[model samples]
Target chain A: MSTLTSPDVGRRTTGRRGAVARVLAAPLVVAVLGLVTLLWLQSIELDSIEKRTLNTDYLVDRVREHLLLSLSAAALVALLAIPAGVLIHRTNSRVLRGVVLALANIGQATPAVGVVILLAIVWRTGFTTALVALVAYSFLPVLRNTLTGLAEVDPATREAARGMGMTRTQVLRRIELPLASPVILAGLRTSLVFAVGVATIATFINAGGLGDMIVNGLKLQRYPVLIVGAALVAGIAILIDWVAGLVEEYARPRGL
Target chain B: MPKPTTIIFPSMDVRGAASGGSATSGGGVSIELDSVTKTYPGQDVSAVEDFSMRIEPGELVMFVGPSGCGKTTTMKMVNRIIEPTSGSIRIDGQDVLSLSPDQLRRHIGYVIQQIGLFPHMTIADNIATVPRLLGWSKKETSARVEELLDTVQLDPAVFADRYPRQLSGGQQQRAGVARALAADPPVMLMDEPFGATDPITREKLQAEFLRLQADIGKTIIFVTHDFDEAVRLGDRIAVLSERSQIEQFDTPAAILAAPANDYVASFIGSGAALKRLSLMPVTSADLSFGAPASGGKRPQLDPTATLRDALDLLVVTGAEALEIVDADGTRLGCLTHAAISAALTQSSPTRGAGPAAGEGVHR
Candidate 1:
């Protein structure tokens, strides 16, 4: 459901801080917990640089790659989900909606790693393969929310649009879609956040994203490098999540 | 699906609004239905069949029936939202079948109980939808939106920029009405436009809609299950039953005076006894003008109000007689308690007419 549904849809629907507050909070909590692991791996006398920037000595490059791959996947997923959502919603065909729902459920069930591996073996892939896997993994929530949001629109509003001389498509655009927007945008927020975190594992195959540090840090059993690499990826995921959530909060329609 | 160069529905003689307080006398709408039938692919029974009627332009005709009796299906057919499997419907003397479904709907306005407002859009943008769709200039659309908001009694500034969620139920319903009236189409189709509201709100809206109908007089075909609403609002109500066929299509007075069949009689029920009061105004016709009761200050009474309503004032004020006032509140006659009782317990609308409804001049 959209945050704007009830005017007070969530405990925190939208404000300057409320949207990103949770997103920012979760990663910090996880990272602070990860501090214990860091302490166990590194000696107390280690140099600050060795401890803090080992795995992520190249955070800037990795962050940009992770962002590019995640964003690209998210955009494609949106394009697919929105049209499918509209078709399933605006039309009276139940069969198509059911099939789409089932497909989305399965998409959601697919593990990010399994999908990456499947795509890598079947298709000639490195970056694109991971991108496809990320997109597929993140597709369901966006698709489901778009469809659900459209479906929840009051039918009376649509009929009123018809009475006002709007054709079916006009009614869908002018009435249904606008009313459904918040929920659909929320779906996009979820997909984008998920894609960000999932894309980090692509570094395992040299897909050349931020996941590289995470993989190398793990393999070498490095202390500071592993901590830094994991922290940067976690931070990037939180950032994208924070941004998408902000969009969802601000762009959400207030009521119907 | 390949484009069928020619669309399924067409556009023709756009309607000229018949605006006035009275919907019946403004637009000369003549609608006809002939053996209309619709059967879903898997359903054995038809939702509507052998349904036929004619309504004059500007007439506020209502379709009323029990739930799931195809009243809504029949309404949808007018706009071709649902196609007729057999038979035809004509609006303003033109064949409905010839027009493509899309074209047919554009010429008609539609409304329903849910009061569906576009939550993302402000009141002004929502009202401007049709005009915007037809390529009207943004300025023109904005001006029309303001005019409509005002016409519907919504403050242009307070409501125009606010989204649907901000409005109260009553305000939302009013906005819905305003939105339906935006394009000024000749024919407007409504299905339970006030059904979702509370009784008092529904009654207020019924009166407001009646007043609006007087002004817009769009060829209106409204559907409701409330008999009192049908009587209070419709110029004529088409009582339907079973498979959506009209049981009786006539004035409300006629329906109460004489039910067409058992279905209508039961539908009306004990309410008919109370409804007769609505038609019984304490007119000069009902006043006996008892020899001047030169006494205490007489209570004021509206000449057009029914005896049942007037009786309360007469009894509460302990007035020997009430000075009847016309529409302008000028004294026209004197209505005593006796006169009101005589008028209220009169038993029927007309002295000679029996309970066969659809008889007399209305039929």
Candidate 2:
């Protein structure tokens, strides 16, 4: 049964405190905190570290590259996963659904670096191979969630729509998708975090990302760069997860 | 089951001479089913078999049977939710099988026991579904939605934006009905539409629905396993045995006066006579215009109150008779205990058919 009442949904309380609370609740707070921490680290760093790690241009390029890699991979996975999940769910043949689900499972079960290495061998090393690897590694969560979300819609609701003369495609588009969006968005969040974390391995395939800094720092004994690189990756992952959380909240069915 | 001769029962309110109501349009299209049967892919026994009946436009006919007797299956077959393996279904002389299932359903309203309003949609959106499908103008759809919400006794301003989860079960059921009626379809199929609510709410909704039907006059096929509900609401009830075989199809009063078989008699339970009393309203009993009560606390009953209520009131008030009044409290006539008896005898079993012939009147 739906517990979502209209008054409680999408109502923005007005006041200074409410404004403060809204800002405090936003995911951008993590981004702000991460920036502050990074500045604090730079303030206390040694001269050698300041020359390399404190160069704003250099740091910005790496952060931009890392984001580009993760976001693109997430986009690719979503582009592929959602339709595949919907198709699998709509298929009448149990065998076909089972086979497609098994394929998705294999994609997730494979090790992240192993997938990258195999893709690198097949397609040659670069951003393309790393992207393909990242997409493969993050595929299951969105696909599985989509299937489960669509399947969980109440059968009686579907029957009522059909009885009322909604065509099959209309039922899916109007009823099933709206009802299942929250679950699907949660799955997207999971895939996004995975993509952010795994994009670090792309540096091994000569794809420039924050992984480049971390790997170089470890090799050259630049502890400041190493800590900053690792810290930045973790920060990005937290930031992306927070945004996805916002989207999921927005997607939740009203009165549920 | 033996094939009984076809019997045509008049609409419950045909005596009212309701000429303006479209339901009384004797020349309108009627729904007719002939030897309809449904069998599962692997099951040897058919789910419903040889179901034959004709329902007049604007009349409400109920199908009552035990669980798994295929009452629901028969209802679904009309909307093409469940296809029949053999037989023909026609609505107003048009073959149902020739139309696309979706198109056929768009012209029909449907309600189910679960009252499956979409959880994600606001009440207004839910009610506007069929209208939107029919491609009505936005302004027209909203106006129709507001009108229907009022018709169902819900405030459009308050409930229009509220989700299904915000309303009580009874309220949700009303919204379900509103949604079904949105397109103003000519035919409706209801499967235990009020079966999920509590008994008190069920009665209230039933009364309200009857009042609504009196106004709109659409052709309705209602399915329920509750015999009492069937008797209360159906203009005519179709009692089915296993495999959707019609045992008896007659008016509620007729069925209570004389159940066609032991199967239907057992369904009516032990109080057939009292059930008949429920069918006869206080207005049906002959009332005397005795001199206006000179007095202290004269018991008053509504003319629309049932004879059963009148009888019960007589026992409780310890009065020789009760005054019957209209909605405005204008004194209409006086109803006596003897008047209730007169109504009962007027519908005695001697005028009908029954298994236990000697038990028609205890007194």
Best-performing candidate as measured by DockQ: 2
* Chain A TM-score, each candidate: 0.79, 0.85
Model 1 alpha-carbon drift over 4 Å, by segment: A1-57, A87-92, A122-125, A254-256, B1-28, B271-273, B294-299, B314-331, B336-363
> Which whole-number lDDT from 0 to 100 does residue B290 have in model 1?
56
DockQ metric for all predictions? 0.41, 0.43
Query: What TM-score, to 2 decimals, does candidate 2 have?
Result: 0.86
Over B162-195, each residue of candidate 1 has an lDDT whose tens digit, in order, gives 7777788888988887776665666778888898
Residue B24 deviation, candidate 2, in Å?
12
Q: Give the Cα error of residue B352 in candidate 2, in Å.
A: 6.4
- Give lDDT tens digits, candidate 1, residues A1-256: 1211223322334575864676577666667756765675565555654545454446677777888999999999999888978877767778988987898788778777877877787786688888878877888898899888888877766666665556678777766787788888888988888888888878755587767777766776765566666776776677677667667756655543
Query: Which numbered prediction scores highest in lDDT against the true structure?
Result: 2
Model 1 deviation from native, Cα RMSD in Å:
5.7
Q: How does residue A189 of candidate 2 score in lDDT?
A: 93
- Tens-place lDDT per residue, model 2, B182-284, is 7666688999999999999999999899888877878899999999998788888899989999998887777888777799899999988778877777777
